[model samples]
Target: MSARRIDRRGFLKTAATLAAPIIIPASALGLGRKIPSERITIGVIGLGGRGTQVLKDLLKLPDAQVIALCDVHPEHHREFENGKGPRLGSTPARELVDKAEQARSGQPGKPCFVTGDHRELIDRPDLDAVLVATPDHWHAAITLDALRSGKDVYCEKPVTHLFAEGQAVYREVAARKAVFQTGSQQRSDALFQQAAEIVRNGHLGKIRSIEVGLPPGYDKPMGSTEVKTPPAGLDYDRWCGPSPKLPYMNARHHRWWRGQRAYGGGVLMDWIGHHNDIAHWAIGEELGGPTRVESVGWTTPDVDIYDTPVDYEIACEYAGGITSRISTKVTEGTKWIGENGWLWVTRGKIKCSNAALLDKSFDRGEWVAGPTGSHVANFLNCVRSRAACIAPAEQAHRSITPGHLGYVSFSLKRPLRWDAKSESVIDDSDADQLLKKSESRAPWA
Candidate 1:
């Protein structure tokens, strides 16, 4: 073993692979685990909150085997220092994997690998696919690199932090002809599909406005403001990736990073992919998203760490005269108002002016899409089938477009007219530049 030196130009610099624990207890031999060649091999990157959740799901797949895991932080006693959850980071994730394997066979799991660097996992020849559950900023870079390596990918949502990155991702996935699934899991829910069925079936008559209720982003100040030393076993610079080089603080890292503009767009950017994804689906737009975005009622904080809006009330106008309102003021999901009656739906419940809308025997609407089963299972099956998953890169890109639009509009304190046909702002170069800040800094570059 040699001392590892990583410069700005490279990660793990020239290391062949990470120092990993190779563990194979006797119980892992059979149990219920699929035999080699019968299972799809998986390498999971970004062992944070979302990554942990997705990893658990991937491990449960009867046809999938998670062989490798990666994260900047080596391990954590708990996923969040501030909150309670499963232990996180690569080592903790590996421990979870080992236990799961043992539980499967009443013995130790198969040999699993761990890495502090993603490059090691991406370059592994044995991996058939990679699950990218990293931060919003790291999604496109990791996805593009994995796609280039000729591996299928299941990347978490909002897919990319910036609009330009989404375009690059779309092109790379197309060029590789890789099977990719964006982690907007709502599409697989029968309830959400039913909601889509209602709107597309013409049961709503003519839709007038759709109101989407989102959470008010970190209302009180979040994360500690104090500057601190980068903790041992944590590579702060690597965690920042292509984002700006900021001083280290617990508040601006971990779960708290979502509050800052440098990393993510607060709750507005996060939930936009979930509920709005459903919103777009119900309408059945071939090329969906708002044609215009304006927000006069929003609250952007003056704090240095958390710069994104804490709350917003935005209006988005789409083609076919469809209009939408997104705000904390609305109910906590999507509500559609139309000429006949109003229908509202969340993951658990659906409310309508008339109860008959949810009748299974009623017209099921011609608007149909797949992932007939679980979201994760669909991605794995699609990997073998070479078919598109329910939530592809392009659809994920479109779903989050208006959130970006609303973000820019709120920041500029003005309304923006969008050319939906061209996917560009109308005659607004300054605003256009904000949407195009997708460049990765050195090393990541």
Candidate 2:
């Protein structure tokens, strides 16, 4: 509650236990048909590109108020209004605080708490939920911490950087009964929902195969070999969080970290959580995944900047003889082929083998793939109503597993047989070793 910036000293104390009960402070609960004063108080962690975009979307909602923000990069919190810093063509975190103030009917807004440590934000009993748009590696740790601290979470996807961390996140969400919305916003798109309905309604009978396309990797390798002084105001050490504290490079510091194996899984992990999730939804396998995975990929020629695969093909065989082929070769949407017909859907377009399938109407209460509102709006509604979100944490975990398996199989250069229930690989000790959850680096571990 103090106005002082949170000091990072001793912040990496043992992670709060995951077994805590759902401790919703009284103000957040029992407000049936509540008024605007009962608006949801949100805290945002990570204020990079995606974080800023999501924050803007949240700002549009009158019932949600962003009360605090935390980012390791202090430049993000720079006051753009004063025009006093190195200007990047990016939105500063302070804009959200200003907007939050305007939303408060011209009265002075509560001070927007800023911190480099997310733990301080999550531990606040006053905060209702936190939007976690941190890097992929930090996703599991931060989301788990928030849920264990009794806050609902809207975690950006691929919900887990490593495959094994999915189950732990899923388990904690279930145990705490906290609403978690994965930031796979495609689940809320109408075209995607229509395609999922066609598939679910048996309009695409006995799915033969689904082809998923994701964004291609960097034509040139990403990241920098140069080690320089950490930028002023940026706590590069805390930014590295659970991953190896590699030397600071501008390329890997902010947005470009997506192309690195340490912080992300290249384009495959970056886009798979969106497109591959649709593939799983259409195949009626949102809760489980393929039994086997095999992949081959090319690591960039120059390892100085990027080491993640530059190109790859992955094939997964699911139960009931369903097959999914995910690669950089196909188009950006999912194409579901089946005995009766096929439906292909993407952000703004939907095409089907039977033209009528595109116009088919569903009966009331029929199963639909998405929520009726924007992804962020749905998370806020669920935060209030205690309803399950469309992109629940468990489904996001299952949806993203193929991407993880693909990366691991490509790195190991071997096929892997997965036991989805056990969340392990079958009979391959080498691949099995890769399935273990990542141990947080020292002090945080």
TM-score of each: 0.88, 0.86
lDDT of 1 by residue, 108-208 (tens): 86778988788999999889899998888888889988988878899999889888888899878887777889999988887787787788668889899
Query: Model 1 RMSD to the real structure?
Result: 12.1
The CA lDDT at 3 in model 1 is 46
Predicted candidate 2 versus true structure: per-residue lDDT over 1-445, tens digit per residue: 3344232222212111211123344456442322223678899998876888898898877777888888887564233222554432123566656766766678767567888899998988778899999888899889888987878899999888887778889899888778899999999887787788778768778988988987777656344447899767778788888888887775666767877778888888888889899888876788878999999555463556766767777899989888888888788789999999787888898888888767545331245554434788888777765768889999999898888888778778889999888778899878788767477886665
- List where candidate 2 sits over 4 angstroms from the true fold: 1-37, 76-91, 222-225, 297-299, 360-365
lDDT of 2 at 88: 28
| Residue-level lDDT for 407 in candidate 1 | 79
> Highest lDDT among the candidates is held by which one?
1
Q: In candidate 1, what residue range of length 10 has the lowest lDDT sum?
A: 14-23
Model 1 misplaced regions, further than 4 Å: 1-36, 77-85, 105-109
